[model samples]
Structures are given as C-alpha cells and as structure tokens.
Target chain A: MIKTSTQNELIQYVYNELADDACTQLEAAFMHDNELAEGCSELLQIQNLLDTALKSPHQRAVQNILNYSKSLSLQS
Target chain B: MNTTTQVSDSALVSLYIAGNENAFEQLVNRHKNKVYTTILLIVKDTYTAEDLMQDAFIKAIHTMKSGRYNEEGKFSSWICRIAHNLAIDFFRKEKRSPMITLEDGSNVFNTMAFAEDSAEQFQVKEDTHARLRELIQTLPQSQREVLMMRHYADMSFQEIADSTGVSINTALGRMRYALINLRKKMLNSNIAYDKNLYSE
Candidate 1:
C-alpha cells in the first residue's frame, strides 16, 4: 500500500529528470516503504522490457541505404 | 577508417553549399538510417517510410542549396526536425487509422522461438505488444507525436518541443501521460504485472 503522493513521486523519479532534492526524497521513501519499493521495481522492469521489445530492426535497411550511396557514387 | 574523410556534419553542409554534390551524399549517408527508422516506426509501414525518408533528404538538400541552413545548430537534429514535421503532415492529411491489427501473418514476434517458455507466456507478450500499439494509436495526436519523437527517435524533450512547436513542459507532460496510459493498459491485459517476469 504505497501512498498516492509517494507513488506519483516515485514514477517521476524513474524518469530521472527530476531535481536532486526530489530524487533524494524518492530514494528515502523507497527505503522506508515496502510497497513503494516493490512498485518502483516492477515499473522499472516493465520499462526495460518494453524498451528492448520496441527497438526496431533496421540494420538491413541501413545497409541498403549504404549500398545505394555507393552505387550513386559509382554512377557519378 | 580514413580520419580526414570523417568531416564534421557542419563541414559537409558547407561543402554542399559550395556546389559540391558529393557532400550532399555524405549528409544523406550519415542520416539515412536514423531518418528511415524513425519514419518507419511512425508510419508503421515500409513503403510510406521509404518515401518519407527520400522526402526528408531532398528537403534537406534543397534547404542547403537555397542557403537557408545555418551552421549554428546540429545538422542531424535539424534534418530530424524536418522529418518529424513531414511525418506529422502526412498523419494529418491521411487521417489514417493507428491500430495495427495482428492478422495471421502480421505478428512480428512469430519469427522468434522462445526456449522452454509456455505457449501462454509467448501469447501474452504478443498480445501486450499489439495492445500497446493500439493504445499508442489512440493517444491524442499531439501526445502520440511527442511520444514517438522522444522514445523511438531518441529526441530530447527540448528537441521535441522545438521540432513540434510546443512548450518543453508540454512535451514532458505528454510523455509522462503516454507512459502512464500505456502502463494502465498493460495492467488490464493478461500479462500479469510481475517484476521477475522481465528479469528472466
């Protein structure tokens, strides 16, 4: 049972775009509250998994563009 | 790797402005992949992505040729800004549906075979991806555009704001809401919220 205020602060903390004092407050809150710690942990995991899964496979496309560049150079 | 060949992007732009066409090719070669991939994720189709990539490069070249490019900023960011605007224009004019329906052969995950996992888990992950995509599509167009630029294109909040002509706070707020909405949607799906599930 994380407090609503603390949970919101923790979500903002994960973005790492918050000010230093806010980050310190989030760290202290996590240390004191089990539910907050667990929720933050779960959200971080979800973020990491989603980031990996959503990465587009564009290596082949990049290679194709490079090949096209070479052919254009040859023609010129 | 030829050290001299790796000229700074600004230098290449200057070269292109001096009527050196090869410099324009260098610029395209450097940014083609990033532009193509960013557009592909936004449009969610290859053909449109290809056309948009070409359009982005052509527009960049035209800008340089016309002497409108200022060397005061990052060339990559400027070109990406152009691509972002073009993608948004396409979205507005097309009014296309955002939902990517997972028909029989359309599942991107079908090619990967997970080892030792139950069919159930695989199905859950796939469903979650599809649901996330649909949810992203449903986002307010502004929020969706910001999310795509921030996450997929790896633009900073400032860059997103500048490119989309919105405030920095608005860009950050849109991303915050986008993630919150996505998390809510995931919670409602069959994929149970388990910290350990992702660690494996």
Candidate 2:
C-alpha cells in the first residue's frame, strides 16, 4: 500500500496544487509505481466526471442579470 | 479575432470595472456553469439556483462598480465564494432538506441548445449531470461541502481550509475521501440496474 502522505500528494498532483519539487518526484514515481499511477488515474477520471455534472442556468435569467447591470449603468 | 482564453479573469474584471460591458459578458459566460452548479448542489433546484445566481452576480456587480472589489484573489474563486455563501444563507433561512427530487437536469438544456444541434448527445450529457448531482446530495455534509468548494468553487485547498475553518491537511483529507467516495458511488449507480430485467 502506498503511504497516506503519498496519496495526499497524488490528490495535490491531480489538482495541480503540489509543490514543484514534489510534483517532479511524483512524476518520476509514476513511471515506476503501478499502484500509485492507477490511483492518479482514478482521481482524474472522477474529477472529470464531477465536472461534467455542472448545469447551466436558463438564458432568460442571465439576460435579466445583464439587463439589470445595463439599467444601473444607464442610471449612473 | 478574440483573446478570450488568453485573457485572465483579473484582466476581465478590470475591464468590466472600467465599464466595458463585453468584458462582463465574457466573465459571466466563462464562469457561469461553475457558479450555477455550486449553488445547484446546495439548493437542489434549478429555478432557485437561477434566482440565487442572479442575486450573487448582482451583489458582485455592485461590489465591482462601487470600488470595493478586492483584486487579491482569483475572480472565479471570489465570485463563486459569493455564490456559495448566498446558497448557504438560503439554506439557513429556509431550513430545507437538500434532498428534494431533482427535475431532470435536461430541463435547462435549452440554455445552451441554441449553440448545438446534437439533441441526442446533449440530452445524455444533461442526464448524466443530473444523476451526478443527485449522487452528490447523498454524500455526507462535510464531504459534499469540501467537494463542492474545491471542485465547483475552484478554491485551493488553503482557501478551502480558511473558508471552512479546518486545517489544510484536514481539508485535503476530506477532499481525498470525498473523491474516493464519489468514485465508488458512480460505479454503484452505473450498474444498479441488471441487464436480466430487460432481456428478451
């Protein structure tokens, strides 16, 4: 099993939050470690899937917001 | 020619503050999906999410226009933080259970349907989004909060730590578990319906 610290680093690495040196080290480890690499792969897949769940608001609502700002601008 | 991708959110905010309306439009289009989803997860209603999103942006409009805007942090994070807070305050005042039945997410598919003609593919995508949001609602409150803040709000772990009142390590740990749990949930939800039931 990979260490908890390594797993945490993997999360940071996927999120692009790990420090540069640690990121370099993790990249090197990925070439040699199958389990660590698989963990990273799963994290990435889930991240993408989570991102796809994003929904857009109706266009009318957005139009209202823009119009409100425009109206305020006109008044100002 | 356009520099949409090349322009930073900060630059756009600066332009908008300088009274460039197009820049504000770009800013809204760029981050609208994230802002909407962040609140949708909290309020669990598209109509309410839309209303709250408008309120959030109006609040932002006033802040940016009134010279109170802070340029210290990423604009996406700042705006989403506002959206997130408004969503939570909504929950507090309403005291509603967030697990209400979701109208299929495709209900809002019309928002972007004007740009794309692939109705079949678009419907599938919206259905997936709806299912995922429903599953997110099933997560424990802490995990759901961390996941939404990090993924939807685009907040760094340090930012999440400060905002959620937890140590950075604890914040990271919660996010780690949240992702792991979400993966497991996705897998289970995918196979819950056996093929035998539909066999000819």
Candidate 3:
C-alpha cells in the first residue's frame, strides 16, 4: 500500500517535480510494488482526463479577449 | 517579426510594449486557452470565467504598460498569477462553492444517459467523460484549487504557495490529497484506467 509520504512523492513523480535520486528510487520501487504502480496509473488517468476534457474554452470568450486587446494602446 | 513559435514569451511582451498590439495577440492566442481553463476550473461558470479572464488580461496589460511587471522574466506565470488571484477574489465575493453550472442553469449530470453494454464504444467513452467531469466537481475545494492551479497555471508549488498564500508544503500536500481523492472516487465509480485514454 502507498503510504502518505509515498502519495506525496507520487504527485511529485507524476509532475516530474521530483529530484533525480528520488525519482530513480521511485522508479525502482514501482518495479517491485504493485500498489505503487496502481497508484501511479490512477494518478496518470486523472491527469489524462483533465487534459483531454478541459482542453478548450468558449470561442466567444476568445473573441472577447482579442477584441478587448485590440482596444488597448501598447505604447510604453 | 519572427513566427510566434520562434519568439519567446518575454520577447512577445517586449514587442507589445514597443507598440505592436499583435504581439500581445500572439501572447493571448498562445496562452488564452490555458488561462481560461485555469479560471474556469476555479469559477465553474463559463461567462464569469470569461469575465475574469478579460479582467486578467486587462490587468496584465496595465501592469506591463505601467512598468510594474517585476517577475524578472516568466510572463506566462505572471499572467497566471493575476488570473489565479481574480478567481480567488470571485469566490470570496460570491461566498459559494464552485458548482458547475450549465448554460441554462440546469444540472448537466441529471441529463446523462449511460450507454447500454451493447452500445458503441464511442458512447461509453462519452459517458465516462461526463462522469469524470461530475467527479471533478465533487473534489474538496482546497484540493481542487491546488490541483487546478498546478495543472492549469503551470505553476510550481512555490509559485502556487506565493499566489494562494500557503506554504509550499501545504500546496504539495493538497496536491497529494487531490490525486488520492480522485483515484478513490474513480475506483468507487468503476472507471477503469484505459491506457488509450491518454494516448489517443
């Protein structure tokens, strides 16, 4: 089972925020740990959902921001 | 001017300051969806999120023009900070949860009709997407905010800490819980992890 600290480490690992040695250790652990691998898979799935489902915003919002930008003076 | 892909965000900001509004356009076109997605995750309303995004860009322009953008160089993160703060301000002013709202003020979840076992695979995919959206809405506010800021704003834990007024450890802790919570929720819902979900 993934401990609390490992859960935190998993977050860092998924985001590539972990340091070199810690990442290496985690990778090695994943090879021997079914629970760790499952946790990592679950985290990756959440990330995938977020990326694919939340990819775009409303088109009107895009136009509105562009229009608002056009009205501004950029001279500094 | 070089292609937007060839130029850096800092260079784009400099060009905008040099009176090329299209430089600002390039910046917006490059980062708009990200900014919008970040704001929408927090505000949970399309129109309000757009308004906050507009406010964010306006504030960004004003700050850059007035020569107060003192972030050293990370222009994208700087704008994200503005949007992040605006979203917090919106929630504080409204004093409500960020409930997902459909355009007609109806519940999107209530309309979901899961496909039968015999249905096409595409229909199941659509159902899963809708279910995941609903599940995201159920995440705790603290965890959800941290997850969104990290995911959408592309902020480091340190940057997220500075923006959200939390310790870096706290930010990281919240992200940990966010992932754990999402995993638990998905498992409870019987949503299997499909490798192709991300690869496709």
The candidate maximizing lDDT is 2
CAPRI verdict (incorrect, acceptable, medium, high) for model 2: medium
Tens digits of per-residue lDDT, candidate 1, B1-200, equal: 56675788889888867766677667776776556656755676666776777677667755776678888777877777777778768877899765544333465434333456689976655555545555666667777777667555556677778877987776777776766676676667555565444433
Each model's DockQ? 0.20, 0.57, 0.47
Report the C-alpha displacement of residue A73, candidate 1, in angstroms.
Answer: 4.8
* Residue B119 accuracy (lDDT) in model 2: 71
lDDT of 3 by residue, B60-148 (tens): 88777777777574777778778888988998899985665433323332222333433565456656665666676688888887887
lDDT (Cα, tens digit) per residue for candidate 2, span A1-76: 9898898888888899999999999999999999999999888877777766667788898899899888888888
Off by over 4 Å in 3: A74-76, B1-6, B97-127, B197-200
Query: TM-score-based ranking, best first?
Result: 2, 3, 1
Identify the runs in model 2 with alpha carbons over 4 angstroms from their true place. Answer: B1-5, B99-121, B191-200
Docking class of 3: acceptable
| Model 2 lDDT per residue over B50-168, tens place | 99999999999999999999999999899999999999999999988766465653454334332353677565555555677778878888889989998999999999999989998
